[model samples]
Target: MEATPRPSINIMTALLLLSLHGFIGPAAMAEQPSISADQASLLALKQHITDDPEDLLSTNWTETTSVCNWVGITCGTTHTSRVTRLNLACMGLSGTLPPQLGNLSFLAYFNITNNTFHGSLPVELSHLRRLQYFSVRGNFFEGEIPPWLASLPRLKYLFLNANGFSGTIPESICNVSTLQTLDLSENQLAGTILPLIFNIPLLKVIDLSNNQLSGAMPSSVFSESPLLDIDHSSNSLSGVLPQNICGNLPNLQGLFLSFNQFSGGIPSSLSECRQLQVLALSVNNFSGTIPRELGNLTLLNGLYLGVNNLIEYGSGGVVSTRGDVYSYGILLMETFTGKGPTDEMFSGEESLKRWVKNSLPDAVGDVLDAKLLSREELTAAKLECVSTILELAAHCCTELPGERKGMNDVLAKLEKIRTVLGQM
Candidate 1:
């Protein structure tokens, strides 16, 4: 699980909080402060918090003090001291949100992440017109995500991950034009994902992983979407992946579809996802030869094809004697460079083959395994033989499948190199 992140506050708000409490409070001790509607709403919310072992709210939220001075409260500087942000993330508070909180018209950011908050989301939250960021993630919230969430006109980031939200995701959520990130992972959400959700104009990240969602993904064209990362892994989804999955999502970077019942050949068109860095298709019923075109994605750092029915392919996209040569070449590089193809260091236009190719022939020693070079009896002949092996690996890893050397030729070269080393 990712660590809960703190929301960012403006410098002006920080300064205002400091000035009101640090400097002004000492001089205004004798004046009487009146409670506003925002204050009443906050106090009402405080009433529902059944557990506060730290006495955070009991000691700080008092009738005598201005609500602006309360912890997790930030009043807007221009909205006549109206509460604009309430962040109680990871505070260990347990409670349900009060409907009265919807009255805070100026609220733009609200977060109660990693808390024990339970019960379905209050429908009153639909009235938060100015709200931009809302997170109730890592909580005990249950029931279906409300359809009224689409009513928040300005909502941008919506996170409800790691909860008990069930039922089909409301298709009405596609109405949020300004939404950027939507995460509903680790939930009980079911039903097929609607295609309109993928066509949301500005949506960049969509995570629906670890859910009960089923059915084949709609074959609709995802046009004009700037989506960067999509994780639909660990679901009951089935059917062949869309043939034109990358046709419209030009900025797609991560495609994680593991642990599902998806069948049929992996789409060859996926190679068009030029920005793709992580491609995970493991633990599925997918069968057929792996696409050789995938080798063209130099930026790809992670390619997981384990626990599947995929097979190695030879030239012209068929299983043959040369089918296993490409993998054997990668094995040679791995043995020499002491690096796997998916090593963290080989991201963004770099791979085990590319790394070795850059330092071949003359500088091969630099990329060679240290243990091999450290042998006291190792001679220049063995070093040259290693260089020859890496050169063979380069031939096998050519971007075009037909250009790759056949397994027969590769084996013949390796045998000659071994014979030469033995004579030395």
Candidate 2:
């Protein structure tokens, strides 16, 4: 629900609209000569909302007063007083838009958020080529996303979230090359998210969450985009997410694909996103052990993966504490060796605990912590104590639950090792 960058206003368009005052015919003479293209559009907008209980438009927007004097209207001080920005957010206005308002040639920034405006967008709005930022968020605007918006060259920010927009997200929207932010969440937009959106060079934020967009999102699209935030959560999107998403999109800061049906292992490549601040993949079907590499993202602030099949989700048929022992063994290996059971190095029958157990006694030096090796001044007794600890860890992580030492026995053995180390 982010507001995007406002478009730069065209001063020349304002001047041209003002000069039209001299060309007024005898019939147009009845109308005020000072009323420019934007003022006329404002009057059409006023007509739609005057029937509301607020009477906001009828009270202030009148011919007796200059449009420049109206509320939410900002006119240029240079040559012409044509309106450049019209902000009427949270006004509680209710009605449909008029086609006449598209005549605002100089209009650049228009905000009508937090209103009750309904009905589909007018085709006439396509005439506002100078428009850059147009937001109707928190309204009841419905129907298909108009394909005509692609014709606007200067349009950079389009916010239509929290509406009733339906039908396919027209591929024509990708035609707006200058677009920097597009928010169409919280609607009924169906069909696959067209990949052409990735071509938008300046696009930084894309919130297509809370819709019906399905199918696998292409990871290759992230390779070149400088996207700062991507929220595709709360949808029905399915399929395995490509593992290279984090590596491909280096500048990515936030990635939200939660509450979907995505199924696959948590990508180990996610460790490459050094700048990632938030990664939300909760309530999905992601499998495999949590990648220990994810701990590498130093800047990561949020990590949500609830209700997923990380370790276990649904019933695993017969349950036992043996699973706890298995988890404990994995944790023990990961804690000391700093490698997860699901790490790329451990595949097929190989695992972190198995590897540590294999190199016991003789090769304990090879897998032992490098910091422990640095303790060169230590006596041989301490080294023997370290080997005993490794053996205890291996015993806790035996392949069979029946063969593994019970918790009480493991604790007793740990105490014995502690006593031996403490005496030295």
Candidate 3:
């Protein structure tokens, strides 16, 4: 028996075989595709918009990648991928919304506010059944609001302020029982008030200011809800305000009815809202004396009742717009000291601002909320910062409205105080 000889191989032949094996390796790759509906939507958005020349989005956004790893996209505990939140706020995105965004079935939050997006809101948004928050304020969006939005079951927050939206608010909005915040201010919406909106039990904040809405204010707007804030200012609403405005809303924090045609006296029953903070009823036709009971609101912060036909309840006590100025000061104190107006500092007719200004040297700790004293572990510098804020509040709440600082001024001063506090 003779042995068979093996065939000889050259170096080039060996390299050719290696190359063939390498080509087959990719076939066995086990990774799933990373492209998601959200990614596709983002890509479409990038293509449609002319802004963001800095490539900020491209740097952090990619398809075939985990959306949880992408910027501004939050995920849940299970890490089951979904575009739960999309915060493109102030990103300067200048384009119309793409309808393909509806593909994100699990998206709960979508905020493209403070941008330059124009044109009508996409009807495709109705497909977002899980959407809880949708804000497009401070934009150029025009045309009537899409009626299908009423079908969104989980929608809790909807802000379309500072836009060009016209026509009456779709009555279907009342169908969203879970809605907590609804802001349609600074729009061109006209017609009478829709009573159905008052029936939503969970509504907490409703701002319809700066619109053309006319008619009597709805009586049952806050009847059965835990609404804490309501702003209907600068509208054409007529008739006297409901007497039991605060009677129903036990937790009412702010009530802004300024620049309207509301008539009658400031209701004494409003004192029942122990948690009342900001109350602005300026530029209305309110008459009669400023209720002495209002002074009993311990939690009151900003009280603006200027340009109204107000009188004092007690003899020799003249009602002045300065009361509002004093209230603003109290608000500043509340912000700095973290205390309500009735909290020890200004318990009686002795205004907080007056006491602090008159006794500047000795008044440093005089206006400090006693609540902060319990936290004895805080540093001395921190305590001084608190004192500085109280002094600043004193300056803001002067006896004259003209002398009292505006919100911008107060905020600037507070920022400075904050910066100093941060250094400490």
Per-residue lDDT, model 1, residue 67, is 84
Tell me the whole-model lDDT of each prediction, alpha carbons only: 0.84, 0.76, 0.74
Separate clash counts for every candidate: 0, 0, 2
Instruction: Mark the 10 consecutive residues where model 1 has the least summed lDDT.
Output: 26-35
- Candidate 2 stretches with Cα past 4 Å from truth are 1-34, 312-424
**Candidate 2 least-lDDT 10 residues:** 312-321
lDDT of 2 at 151: 90
lDDT of 3: 0.74
Where's the lowest-lDDT run of ten residues in candidate 3? 26-35
lDDT of 1 by residue, 204-252 (tens): 9999999999999778555767999999988999999999898888899
Candidate 1: lDDT over CA atoms? 0.84
lDDT of 3 by residue, 136-159 (tens): 998988888778888899999999
- Provide TM-scores for the models: 0.68, 0.66, 0.67
What candidate 3 gets wrong by more than 4 Å, as runs, is 1-35, 62-67, 76-80, 221-223, 313-397, 400-424
Candidate 1 contains a number of clashing pairs equal to 0
By lDDT: ranked, best first: 1, 2, 3
TM-score, cand. 3: 0.67
Clash count, candidate 2: 0
